[model samples]
Target: MTGRIHRTAAGLGPAAPVRAVHLGLGGFHRSHQAWYTAGDPEWGIAAYTFRNTELPRALTEQQGVYTLLVAGEEAEVVGSLSRAHAGADRESWLADLASPDVAVLTLTVTEAAYAVPEPGQDSAVQRVVAGLRARHRSGGAPITVVPCDNVPDNGAVLRSVLRSATRDDRRFAAWVEEQVSVVSTVVDRITPAPTDEDVAAALRATGLRDEAPVRTEPFTEWLLAGDFPAGRPAWERRGARFVPDVGVYQQRKLWFLNGAHSLLAYAGLARGHTTIREAVDDDALAGTVQQWWDTAARHIALDPAEVAEYCRRLRDRFAAPGIRHQLRQIATDGSQKIPARWLPVLRAERAAGRLPGAVVTGLAAWLLHLRGGEVRDPRAAELVESAGSVRRALLALDEEVGADDELVSAVEAELHRT
Candidate 1:
């Protein structure tokens, strides 16, 4: 912990153990999970970005110190963040994974990282398995890999991919199958990408220019089910809920918040909107999102009242004038996201002999976004391969990527119109 940053909550007692490794050290991790970790002295996170070197360099300079501003409905919750290490220091990251001191691996690599293509039939999933195999061979400690992304059955998906990727390694494969636990989770928070102005404001608020600072809406919820082989943070203390089944909770978020977010990204973008706030403020676009949520709420497994409450909360979060979540940022990787976020309910509604109007509209917008040639995004590479066949793309997605004949036809009709 030498030269590392420390942010003490006055009278907050002792620090927790440093026992977890986070794979993607981006803004959301800084704000939500790290924020929760701040309350426990039992775990400190060692964070690694996928391939970028900028965040690590910045944090190294500041001794890994940063601040998280939880902008609430009527107030802001500002606090200093401590107990984090950068993963760019590869030796340290790998060493920690191999140590009993670290018992958990958390991931937030986003939707695309899960499905990147590789030579032959290999993909990024295989690459992750190969990495895990190497670590296992080198005496990496038994631990849990918790995926904090929005996808359903995330843990199972990862486990299948890892097993598939390492089929030849019977010994190694068995070790992973028995010892490695991949936990699925439902994570919710509305954290916008920080702008330069927002960064400056954060610095002035704390008198420190945190190169990797994070800003988020006040509401935060996490539901997880999995066991840690070694140990884990006493995160349950900070309003983190553990349950036998996180299905209902996961569905509530995926369809309402994530699904609505996609609607805003695709449909709103077509309407010349850039930021989520801009899109939500527009009557037509905002209504589109609200109406989608209305139809989607009916499909969720949770109580109608609870879904309604969640939607109300989403409105408040999206209305934040201080947040600057870009439409294009959420708009990217539609190929991966649509299957997880939107398709399930569409398929469900169609199975019940109903038209999935909002879902079809979102699918249409996504197809338009993927049509290629006009929209220029840095992440354009992911959308290129699947541009020609909407049906094939939708079908190839996971089983949970649900849609039926009527729903598919509606989307197809809309795509044709576009």
Candidate 2:
């Protein structure tokens, strides 16, 4: 390798001034928001990793520059990030939030991170409350808070949690109400955790050791709803959509894209498959995944034609040969993700007096995967302890799902068949 990548060596003169602060900086953040901001000269991100210092260290070493390796295509060097910091860098974090020039704050801290925290505990909500307090005490300016996780009504979800965090401080909460604008967003991209092989490929291609290279699929889509009071980037120029409401798009993606990925992850692992391509390529698993998609589509509010086109594109994206999306990665946090991705459709189909057979199978697979003893979840104990019984597993997922004897029986039957 020639050396570590830098703005100058990567053919980028200098990154933009820091005008945005991003939390939970990971592969998806790098591949999606950072890449989108690369097209705008006015925005630069001060990215901070949630818990891992390695990513921040690497990106900081590289001067917040990294390679975006799209599957089966040439890689691009992205430099929209001005600086990187570990989450423990609270002084800098608060300073960034306090800066009047920083108008945007984005999050990709996963669906489970939005939960209100226990007293004397640190959480995503607690962190945001701290930042807002700092900003209020300094020079309070309007800032757009964007939640790019897969939760439905993500902006509302975040705002509600923030309210809980700031319940005792009505003054701070009132200031937040007057100044903060939470934008709900639907973000899509398949950025797998970079493997050693990916790092080698990057070095071979660019003659530089890219310690933090992000390998992603070619397809990327982002839809956002709500306001940016202090202004924001022209993300539409980079194919990001500003919709009147992101609810429908979120349903379409959560049920179809994320839902199907979770299916393949759980079911595919049970069937002894590895990467996403291998899992989708299995004819038997593919059929079940398609059934899940069709069933989920029946519940989304979008036009059938639009949903179908999205599914068609998803199939191609999942079958992409160059990307190595590990099943275990998507399979993490199933206790949190399954409800968001599958519960709405499951509840709807059941209410319509339909069995939703494919969902039954998906549920069975997840239960089995839980018992396999490798899942990382806040509720792992509850899930694993209940996995032996379909009823218990269903209860662990949601009380309504478990309370329904009929639904539990269906899941039980599916588990037996598997």
Candidate 3:
């Protein structure tokens, strides 16, 4: 901790009413949404950390103000969040939801959080259902729930989950149907967890100790498509785009950016590279990423020039020297990630009767990664046990891909190449 202290109120005016409540308060939210919200003084966010008490405690101690360190660029204190709480704070969470002022609810919880989540289980959807129930009972003011997770059709997915969660109560379900809008979003930013050096540098630069400083690449984007019934901040003024549809943009990100990232994570780890920059610096792995992007681009419906430029920018972002995005970190939760990042494209290519080499290679690398050592995944036991069967792994991930012999053979051949 540094000697100097800069309170949130010092830089920004009196704490604004909470107009947004965010789930999964991590570095990405700070670097992306909170940074955009900082552009508008009238909006303040009540952010909740995902299962971590330390971050919320630290942010609370700092008066919900922290430093944003743009890797190899600049550092600035962000004051958009007015409150921070542990995810388990039911009273505070319910109160915030019941408040009529909160018009937008954003989430950065990962994909697995929304899958068959039991009520009151550490599930993002469960928490949202509880909040929405509270809001519905308390005047049922309309709110837009924006999912910032990197899943395709995230808005619809969330709505489906909410529907299932509240299916027992027809009144609550009806209220949700009438009063809530789920917004699909395309959010991009390479926000790596800050290193000890980053913390020291922030202290040197600002003369204040920021326990929860976020370090991210300079590139950032947020595209939202949906209604905000209770209104929202002018986030568009701060680089966020409100488009009519985010499908093309979402596919571009999911396939090109996130798909390439998954490829690098598995393949790079297999090659002993730790960070994304090191992986991209390796000629073979970088070529593999490029190949994956080329194959992925075939499926996106965006303008050719835009897709090309997006791919070009993706290469630059991946090669950022200052960003130490760890491949191991990306490799975690591969079971949940691969379905969205790889399977859709792989299935589409297979349906077109063309076996995608890059997709096969990525799948093989992930299988090889499973064979490498113990991994952190919910389905780790099944993955380890099914190492010999590509069909088993694919089926375990999604039953829809049921024993596709041709696809299995392609993945096996690629696995042998590894």
Report how far residue 351 has shifted in candidate 3, in Å. Answer: 2.5
Q: Compared with the true structure, what per-residue lDDT tens digits does model 2 show for residues 1-418?
A: 2789999889987878899999988999999999998889888999987778998999889999998888888999899999999889999999999999999999989888988888878777778888989999997888989999988899999999988788798888898988999999999999888898878888877888899999998889999889999989878889999889988888888889999999999999999998889999999989998899889877778888988898899999989888999999999999889999888998999899998877888898998898899779888888888888888788778999899998888878888888
Which has the greatest TM-score?
2
How accurate locally is residue 394 in candidate 1, as Cα lDDT from 0 to 100? Answer: 57
How does each model score on TM-score?
0.84, 0.98, 0.95
Q: After superposition, how far is residue 66 of candidate 3 from its true place, in Å?
A: 0.6
- Give me the candidate number with maximum lDDT: 2
lDDT of 3 by residue, 1-418 (tens): 3453346433556566799999989989999999999899899999997679998998888888888888778788888999999977989999998899999999998877767675457677778888999999899999999999988889988888888888899999999988999999999999987688877877876878878888888899999999998999889988999999899888888888988998999999988899999999999988888888778878878788898899889888988777899998888888888888888888888889988888777888888888888687878998888866788877887776647777788888877777
Tell me the TM-score of model 1. Answer: 0.84
What is the C-alpha lDDT profile of model 1 across 1-418, one tens digit per residue?
A: 1222224422233334457777777788877777777667556676776566777676655545566666643222222232345443556665666666777778887766665345463333543565476568778568888888877777777777676666777998888888788888888877777767656655566554555667777778988888877767777887888887888787778788888898998887777888889989999777778778887777766777877787888898888867788888898666667777877777677678877667767877876777644454434554555657666545654334433455567777877665
Q: What does the lDDT read for residue 24 in candidate 3?
A: 88
Q: Candidate 2: lDDT of 373?
A: 90
